[model samples]
Target: MVAALLPRERLLMGPGPSTVPNRILRALAAPTLGHLDPQYIGYMDETCELMRQVFQTTNQLTFPVSGTGMAGMETILVNLIEPGDEVIVMINGVFGGRMKDNMERCGATVHAVEIPWGQSFTLDQIRQAVADHPQAVMLGIVHAETSTGAFQDLSGIGELLHQQGMLFAVDAVTSMGGHDLQVDAWGIDAIYSGTQKCLSCPPGLSPVSFSPLALEKIESRTTKSRSWYLDVSMLKNYYTGGGGRAYHHTAPINMVYALREALAIVVEEGLQPRFERHREMHQLLRSGLEELGLEYIPDHSLHTLNCVAVPDGVDEAAIRKRLLNEFDIEIGGGLGVFAGKAWRIGLMGESASEKNVLTMLAALKKCLGD
Candidate 1:
């Protein structure tokens, strides 16, 4: 006979899948409802409104996509970019690289502007890129580069893009609730994020928003979007309300419940306070790590995710293993070029607390034999 499945709880201090709060878990366990049920539709509308509150945008088209963060990325690209459309992508880290790849897969002519992994692009570089690629219809960038813990500033870039007659798209997968993101104020035409990172929700849904300009661009696309499932035109009808609501696919009922609950938590805490909490936790962890002779990697690091350099002669993988085994704590190692050379410590959402920071520091000290 098959045994009943059970999983041990571990503090998630990794790059993602931040530790889910009990309230959110309970929300996930709520009874599932039919996708087209009127109650579920009401819940969906509430979720969209909550997303707007968190995103700080009045965008009517904001809603959660059915897949993870990457799905949100694809949805934005495939809808706005058609075959042979020129698009400029800023690539500084893994997620930025993924954006470039996604644009290419959409058959768009991509102009990729790259900087070092740990550094962010300046406004001058952005201006130069626009000058170099005048024909590009859209420019995509990662607001918080998760792989390298680098936070990109979107403050003035949005207005610049709009003035240049180019749409501004952003990947906020790791920054959404943890950082200050004003989608409307920043003039972001379109943006996408994941639930798992700073929302303190499970990995499944990707919340995305489209400005009126972005909607116009998507509507004006000469060719059909390559992805039928992620096509925003069909998605908007289902996500947006009114008497005429069409079903694109079966939405993830329980995940929506969980996200609704998580977003409610965000709204209750308020965005500024939530962002300050994350910053405080990051500072606490930074002080502790620096005391242990570690240094940060990013020029402008994300408060939600911290990437620190590992000391020479230390077994990065072994320390991670010991933390998981002996301390029942989970943290992340570096990716790509920083693999085995850095540690990616996340203090996202519910996991961003003084208790978790102190616990991780103490556990790490033991694992490092200090």
Candidate 2:
């Protein structure tokens, strides 16, 4: 081995992998527990219960799937979409596009309803699509488009889908813990989220929940799920029953430990208070960005994930590099159609503190020399 790695320490206000809390980091070092150990099983059940509180759902099919956020996306598609099923995917940002790709890969016919990047889908458009494709089995969209920081109205879209008898699925990878996401209240059939964004854990696990109707659809599928590991049928049994010890995979023992500690912190702080913290930090950042004469692409739909428009005569990449190298502050560059135009600043979980907000604003100001 060469010299040990010396990574530069920076305020991670990027698209994801948000700054983790010290307590959660310490928990990652606790003695590893066997996957099926009785104590570990108890921890697992407790984690699921806490997730239900965060998700604001009583859906029994909720748990942490042992992979990244994308795993949660694939889990819903593979388990629910049959070969000939129709899926209407509302595409506004990269994550929505990913959902469409995942659905198509599952051999389902994907009807993509496109919206401009940095914008959100409207309920009228969704209802029109559902009417156009009467046989659609599922409708999918990203609740918070991380690439654009545009939050779609999940309640409106979910209600429209529910009225049409279409299963509502959302990629809440960046929204779950930061924003108000009541899965049952919104009538969401299937939802997925990553631990890193707002949960403040490392990015190894995806927390997913399925409504009973969605589970019924999965159960009644005529074709076997394309991916065996992601199939909810057997995994549900393993996670929910028989002592809550199912050997789906290794289960990432240390990562699970980190997530449990992170969720514990969330519960201790309380979800409502945590959401308010994120909202407050977001407002601070927004005000600072406006003071610097920068504007957001989507003015009305600003999320806790703030995307600021890059100013004229600025090299977006070079400025980000200089900020990291000189000030030890990390912010994300734009993606897709918004590339070279914006920066995604995440105010989530532990990173949503006032100190981080002020630090990032000062660093960004210095970078812009303003």
Candidate 3:
């Protein structure tokens, strides 16, 4: 067999998979232990605890699902949504659209409240939607819309959901470790996150949590979940340690080790500091973009995932390709309606540093011939 060779240098600044820290890479290389070993079980328990801390919740159901962001999204939607159930999904970006698709596939009637791309939903709009669909089982929104770089108003919509006595679920794939995600305080019922974003780990696992109300709904389901592997009911026993250490499936042991180390780095940096660092890097990037005469898509809800509107004469795809070929730096193009209109620059995890911001700015300026 030929030896596997790879590029020695590359910077990951894409939407989902941010640059993994060296510490996490080292942890992945640590001696592999038996998946069911007592020490490994203890490590699993510690990971669960760290997830709760990172999620800012006391929910016992907090654990890393053995998949990517979509896995976490599917796990929550498939188990919580039953046939003919009414799920009110707010769509302002691609992720929201994905949520609608998943919810519909779960046999729920998806009632969508949508706004223009690059814009977020207003409380008034959501209030109207809620009034229109009073029988909706859950209110789902994307906390950080990675596609549009729009941060939706969790406080306003969250209050309305609470008043309507509906479950609140958020797709926090891009916001979990970067922003101040208050799952319990915001009254969120079910939340999902990916390890590849602000977590600074590889993309194999998805950290997920369910509020007591959500867990209760899952437990009280009349029919078995459509997804057997993703059913939280069965998976909980495996993570929380029941008799015989029931093997649901083989866990991604090395990925979990990397994730645990990633979580440790988050704790060391502290969540507030981490959020501030992202904000600072974003500010630097935004300033540089503004200096280059580029404008941001979203207004007040501007996320660290800066989505800059491409100039009229710029070849968006060509520029991205040039950056990849010449600088070995990867940024993202737009999605959905914003395709070819904007560029996505991620400031997540270790990639959320001032040096990276400056490097990206210089590279982009060169790519633009500015």
Candidate 4:
């Protein structure tokens, strides 16, 4: 006979699904309501407003897509991309490669500007890409690459693309709720972010937003989006405010509850303070690692996610295993090119705490026999 489900509490210091707070978990346990129930609909509206505040945008199209971060990416791509369109994809790490794949699947002719996985792209490289791909209608960039912990600066890139009449898309899956993401100020036309990272929520819903320019392009698309489930044109009808509702799909009722509460907590704490907390925790971890003779993978890394080189002569997987089994802690091994050669540590949401950082340092010292 199958036993009851009981999962141990492991301190999540990995890339995502960061430590969820008890308040958010309790919100998820609240009785499931009909997807379109008035109370639930009100909750959805509030969540959208909260998302706008978190993203620093006044875009009315902001709402949580009922899936993981990848779904949000596909939603933006399928709604904006069609056959024969030229899109410049900036590939600095695994998530950027995923964007390329998504673009190709949408029948977009992709022009990729790639750099070393652990570094941000140079301005010259970006300029060259746009100059070479003169017909490109869109530029896709990953803001926080969890795989490499490299942070891309969209501060000026948005204005650069806007001047050329190109739509700007961003994957903030790992940066949202943790980093300083200014969707409007950065001129990001279409952006997607996950709640699991810095929102102190379990992985499920992905918050997405589209600027007016992006919505105009979607409205002008001649062909249907390849993905019916992720079609923003269809989703907008149900998600946009003060509209007659059309049932698209049954919303992830409980996940919405969790996200609503999580976003509320973020609002209570304020964005600047949350971002500062993540940065300070990252600094604490960085200093601790440096004292242990460890080096960061990237010269400029993300405050929410940190990548560090695995010590030579040490078994990387074994170390992670020990960190898990012996210390009841959880961290991540690297991905793609850096796999088995590095570790991906996350200081996200509730996990980005001074106590957590100190505990991780103490545990690692013990495991490393220091």
Instruction: Give the range of the ten consecutive residues with the poorest summed lDDT in model 2.
Output: 242-251
The model with the greatest lDDT is 1
lDDT of 3 by residue, 1-370 (tens): 9888875566888786888878899999888888888899888889889999999999988989989999999999998999999989999899999999999999999999888877887788888999999999898999899999998868766678878888899999999899999888888999999999999898999999999999999999998999988988888888877556688887888888999999988988998998888888888888899999999998644445888899998889999998899998989999888899889989899999888888999999998984
lDDT of candidate 2 over 204-230, digit per residue (tens): 999999999998998798889999888
TM-score, candidate number 3: 0.97
TM-score of candidate 4 on Cα atoms, chains taken together: 0.98
- What pairs collide in candidate 4? none
Per-model lDDT: 0.94, 0.87, 0.89, 0.92
Error of 4 at 20 (Å): 0.8
Q: Which prediction has more favorable TM-score, 3 or 4?
A: 4
Report the poorest 10 consecutive residues by lDDT, candidate 1: 239-248
Compute the lDDT of residue 246 as modeled in candidate 2.
59
**Candidate 1 error regions (>4 Å):** none
Clashes of 4: 0
Going through the candidates in order, what is the number of backbone clashes in each?
0, 0, 0, 0
In candidate 4, position 232 carries an lDDT of 84
